[model samples]
Target: MEHLFGVMLVWLLAAVWIFLLVSWAITGDVSAVEAAFGSVVALLLAIASAQRAFPYVVPFSLATLGGGAVALPVLRAYLNRAAHAQMDAELIERACLAYEFDPKNYGALINLAEVCYKNGLLEQAVRHLEHAIQQAPVMAANEKRRLRMWQDELQHHPKLGYTPCMHCGARSSVGAVRCERCRHLLLPLLVHGRWVPRQLVHKAVAVWGIAVGASALSLLWREQLTGLNALVAILATLSVALGLIVWVVRR
Candidate 1:
């Protein structure tokens, strides 16, 4: 176990050094290596002091760490674009097939339309969304209206050739995955055809979680609840953190 940690530390430092070295090589910027100097040294010292690994140094300059702040965001944005550039064709086909199996379902139809729009089938997307709106029942009035608005926008605005938000009529750049006005995803794993703002649903859920958390804290303060009752409330409160972690990791 001790040897495993030592090897991991060695590989981690080597990886960081190589990354900075490569960044410098490609960008012809010394700051790429210099900016991480202090951090790398500190980590090495900490590991050596803990007797977990030997102290080592890379090609980084010994000067005070600075510069390269501007490069970070540019690098991150490039990576994000690269990540979303390719579509998983098989996944899309499966989604389309699933929607096909339930053509009469309004939510399914809207989902199909969203997929079609993403795949650049604008006419098909508009037609499916229009069908959803026409078939949507009274209970889905608000949702249907939202769909109607987007469908109408699509019909009138042929220049909206890019991906448009299902929730908002605003169109984003081609290959973009989110609406500029609404930061919610433009892709699937949607909730209820996502006619409702994801932000609203998140806020509602956060409020509910806060209420539950407060209840649990009050129970601890009062110390009056039974063991089972207290345990249940505490678990419910703790579950929020776990839920958020899962959502973030999966996303």
Candidate 2:
């Protein structure tokens, strides 16, 4: 056991030395190598002073430790860069697809526009957003307001070739519903004056809020009712009940 401890300590010291050597090679500074060597010596002294420190980690082999010390940084950097590139590509593709499928999907358009603007594709982003506004349902007053703002801004800004009406190929506001030339509707008109039954939305929201609040309250006090086990069970049951209420109201 003492021999094993001696060998393991030697291996650890070697690993620390290897790390310092790599750092010295990268930075090419005499002071950096000296600092790293001092840190490793301090670490070794601390380990030698602690009798129980080496025993727990005895089963790991020296070769395994050495290879791991070298491989870890290389593997980590490769994985990180690969993941970042994949995410960026996916986000851009999703943004493009969203605009193509539903030009009026304003949330997606906004996300795409933001990305484009950040990356210096401002004109393309504006074109996408303008097209989104034009296609969005005009019945929603908020949507109309959004479209009006973008249109008002675009008119003052550098004019790109007008986005032709999707239906009639005539130059018009991206928000234009009916084509002036063909008389065909390019997008659904928002029903601004149409009445929604206020009672239905109000009742649904009220019931949902009450059920959720009751579930949260029950979860907080469940410990007194039956202890940890019962608390977990009751919390699970109440959460399910709350979810059911949400689903029903949404439907």
- CA-lDDT, candidates in order: 0.49, 0.49
TM-score of candidate 1 on Cα atoms, chains taken together = 0.31
Write model 1 residue lDDT over 86-144, tens digit each, in one string.
Answer: 33233444444555576566666666667666654565566666666667666667656
- In model 2, what is the error at residue 161, expressed in angstroms? 9.2
The lDDT of model 2 is 0.49
The per-prediction tally of clashing pairs is 0, 5
C-alpha TM-score for every candidate: 0.31, 0.26
